[model samples]
Target: MTGRPNDWLLRQLPYGMLSEDFFVRFVSIFQEQAGTLLQHADNLPYLADVDVTPPAMVRHMGEWLGMPGIDTSYPAATQRRILRTAAQTLQWRGTVRGLTHLLELYSGGPVHVTESGGVYREGAAPDDPAWAVLEVDSTGPLSESDFLALVLDEVPAHVQVEVRVAGRTVWPVLAEEGEMAS
Candidate 1:
């Protein structure tokens, strides 16, 4: 006589009374359930898929992904973008590209970053002090203090940052018949 298969159903039933067909069916069902559970486990990493995942789950995954600017103050779509691009942004950390990207995100405008005091020479030391000027062309409603704070959070710790809010200036045209007024 054949031995019973190692399964919960087999353990509950008498070994001698079990039929081969019954054991095969039970094993098939167990395999199907295990496959389904494994499939669900495999989908855990894709919890950020907005179509299928809940918003709360996506936010939780964003937290796990350690995305910057993931706070509730930002829109859900913005947070999602940050989480999706977390790896790429981390690769650009401490770089002008990264700072520009961050400033644009926070200020909702174009950003220009310029650095001074790091002039390269043939025999200059690598550890030279540099200052960065961040000129933001902000069309949004962010206040000066808020804009400066946002820039400060993204700039590298070693560089001194000067935040400038730039805007278009229009001067009155001088009349053709008269001299310009001082």
Candidate 2:
């Protein structure tokens, strides 16, 4: 005959259990583990919801959205803000409004974005077309090349840009290596 492990144990159990009988024993263990597993499963859907999602998960969400210059060193709130507005930024991508918004978010400061398109003047326009200029404070996380590539990815391929970081201008597409993929 097989002897039960708890045969010699007392009938009553701790933590709200009535008894350590077969029915209660298996159910208690399964119940505890299952509740925890279910909680984790339920949270899977919320991982994409930036405001409520875990801080560490925010980076992965941003990456999944294909946003550039989401620096790992950035604070959790900043990461959340970036991830949250990624869709809005994507909607306005390539426009001056979009570029300015993106750069401001990245720098956590004001940005000036001036593009050459849509200008209507009475006199003849200059023979040489002027590229867009993005002026931002230089205190952000991205290196100059990375920032340049990020901007390039936003604009049309035909449009080149000049970036002035903290009043220092890097003229006419500073991507010595290459532009970052959009």
Candidate 3:
């Protein structure tokens, strides 16, 4: 019969030598333990199919699935948030909102996106090149190169992207005065 190892072991036992009460008790205990194991096995597929939105499952199974936004480099809470929102953000892919969200996620700050040529003015042609400018105001610890890489990874190939860092001070215009005051 198709059954667990415990069932086969019980079948091979010398049942004739055992008292009826002893045999019944032993079989009952074996079934109880084996049934629990079988139930867990049955749930394995459901667990595997669970989405990454659950923080516990993301922490446990993320590496096996290579899930996005579950990087260990980020803080635990950030990783959980990223996993929770990954699917939602992916739905907006190729849009300005998506890029802005991605930049915010990677930089841990606010992002502003400005687009050009995508909208049709009254008489404008539809073929105009679309471009976007991303302004990031971040005081987080991400380096410039890492921030750029993260932004670039999310941007669509068809859209040109310009990145500008906010709050930087530009050099003051020179005057005939010997020194410039801040």
Number of the top lDDT candidate: 2
- Candidates in order, TM-scores: namely 0.53, 0.69, 0.55
What lDDT does model 1 reach? 0.62
lDDT of each: 0.62, 0.72, 0.63
By TM-score, is 1 or 3 better? 3
Candidate 1 per-residue lDDT, tens place, 23-133, comes to 767766876676566667767766658545656665676666554335566667766665565545767766788777766766677888788644478877466577787
Screening candidate 2 with a backbone cut-off below 3 angstroms (N, C-alpha, C), the clashing residue pairs are none
TM-score of 1: 0.53
Q: How high is the lDDT of residue 79 in model 3?
A: 62
Error of 2 at 97 (Å): 0.6
Please state the error at residue 16 of candidate 3 in Å: 8.2
Model 3: per-residue lDDT, tens digit, 1-182? 23556554456567673557777677868777877778677666666444423456666654543343355666667766665555557777778887777677766778887888455667775665777777777725577766666666677777766677775422222347745522
RMSD of 3: 9.1
Q: Arrange candidates by TM-score, highest first: which order?
A: 2, 3, 1
Q: lDDT ranking from best to worst?
A: 2, 3, 1
Separately for all candidates shown, the number of backbone clashes (residues 3 or more apart, or on different chains) is: 0, 0, 0
